[model samples]
Target: MFKADLPGLKEEVTVEIQEDDRVLQISGERNFEEENNDTWHRVERSSGRFTRRFRLLENAKMDEVKASMENGILTVTVPKVE
Candidate 1:
C-alpha cells in the first residue's frame, strides 16, 4: 500500500503496472491556470509533470492492484499472492 499527497488535481493522475517488468508507475501533470485580470503578489504553487516508479516484489499481485484519490491524497493498494 502506498499513499501520496496530491492536492488540486482531479482526473489528471494515472497509475499503471508495466507488463514486461514488475514495476508500478504513478504519473501526473499539473498545469498553471491564469485567470482573467488576476494579480499575483506572491507565487508559491508549483506546476509540472511528475512520475514515480517502484519495483514490486515477486509476491505482489499486479492484477489486483487498485488506486483511488480522495481529499488531495492518492492511494495505491497492491495485494500479495497467497
Candidate 2:
C-alpha cells in the first residue's frame, strides 16, 4: 500500500505498473492559472510534473492493483499474491 498527499490534483493522476520489473509508478501534473485582472503581491504556488516509483515485492499481485484519489490524497493498494 502507498499513500500520497497530492493537493489540487483530483483527476490528473496516473498509475501504472511495469510488466518486466514489477515496478509501480504514480505520476501527475499540476498547472498554475493566473488571472490578468488581479495584481499579484506574492506567488508561492508551483506547477509541474511529478512521478514516484516503487519496486514491488515478489509476492505482490500485479493484476489486482487498485488506486483511488479522494480529498487530494492518493491511495494505492497492491494485494499480495497467495
| Cα lDDT of model 1 by residue, 1-82, tens digit | 9999989987899999995799999999999866666576555678889999999999998889999999999999999988
Quote each prediction's TM-score.
0.89, 0.87
lDDT of 2 at 66: 93
- Estimate candidate 1's alpha-carbon lDDT, on a 0 to 1 scale: 0.90
Candidate RMSDs in Å, in order, are 1.4, 1.6
Q: Identify the runs in model 1 with alpha carbons over 4 angstroms from their true place.
A: 38-40
Error of 2 at 19 (Å): 1.9
Report lDDT (CA) for all predictions: 0.90, 0.89
Candidate with maximal TM-score: 1
